[model samples]
Target: MNGSVTSQDLGEIFKPIVESFGCELWGIDFNNSGRSRLLRIYIDKTERPIDVKDCEKVSRQISGVLDVEETISGDYVLEVSSPGIDRPLFSIDQFKMYIGSKISLKSRIQKEGRRKFNGVLKKVDAQNIEVEVGKVDYVFPHSNIESANLISDY
Candidate 1:
C-alpha cells in the first residue's frame, strides 16, 4: 500500500492501534530520506508524561502491526516518542486540556495580514478555542486552524 493510500488514511488506520495502547495518538510524520524514510509516531498520556519504556513498547507493537499490514513499504525508521512541551492542540478536547496555559496559533487565512496569535488559552468549547490576546478575546474556529502549539515556558 505504499503508493495506494495517503498518510491521512494510514493515520486513520493507525489511530485505533495507538489508542488501544492507552496513548493519545498526537500525530504521524513521514519524511522520506535518501536511504530510508522516517515514520515518527507522537503519543502522549492525557494526564501525565510518557517514559522511554512506554515509547519502546508502543514502537514494538506498532512495528509488528505495520509490518504485517504493510501500510507503507520500503525501508523506514519507526520512532515512537512523546509530543513534548509544545504538544499540538488538534482537537477541542486538546484545546480544553490546555486552557489557562499560553498558546500560539496560525490560521489557514490571514487576519490583518497576520496568521499568528499568542495568548493564554481561555476556553475550548464545541464551537471554538478562546484566547485572550492583549485585552481582547479572540475566538478561533477549530476548522480554520492551520497549526497550534502550546507556548513554551519562559
Candidate 2:
C-alpha cells in the first residue's frame, strides 16, 4: 500500500501487533515526502515509560510482519517510537485523555480568522473539542483539525 492506505487501516493492521507486546498503538503517521514515504508508529504502555528497547522490539516485530504481508511499497522509513512529551493527538479519545493540558493544533479550515491555535484542552466529546486560548474558547471539529500535539513546557 502506498499513500492510498488510510491511517485507520494501518492502525488496525498494527494495533494487534503492538498490543500483543503490551503496548498501546498511540498512532500512525504515513507521510509521502516526494520519492520516499515515512511510516511512523507511536507506542505507549500504561505501566511504564517507553524506552529504546521498546522501540527496537516493536520495530523488529512490525518490520517482519510488514515484510511478510507487503503492506507497504517503495522506499519508506518504518519508525516505531514513543510519542514523547509532545505527543501528537490523533483521536478524540486521545484528546480526552489530555484534557486540562496545554495543546497546540492547526485546523484544516480557518477558525476565528486563523488556522493555528494554542491553549489548554478544556473539553472533548464525540464531535469536537473545546480549547481555552487565553480568555477565548475555541471549538474545533475532529474533522477540521489537521494536526494536534501536547505542549510540555517542562
Best-fitting candidate, measured by lDDT?
Answer: 2
lDDT of 1 by residue, 1-154 (tens): 7744555776787788888878888886677556777888888887779999879888988899888988777888889899888876667777877889999998887776788999899888887888898988888888788778898996
lDDT of 2 at 68: 88
List per-prediction Cα lDDT, in the order shown.
0.82, 0.92
Worst 10 residues of 1 by lDDT: 1-10
The TM-scores, one per candidate, come to 0.75, 0.94
lDDT of 2 by residue, 71-96 (tens): 87777899999999999999989999
> Which pairs, if any, clash in model 1?
none
Write out the backbone clash pairs for model 2.
Answer: none
In candidate 1, which residue ranges exceed 4 Å CA deviation? 1-8, 29-38, 46-48, 73-77
Q: Native-vs-model 2 lDDT? A: 0.92
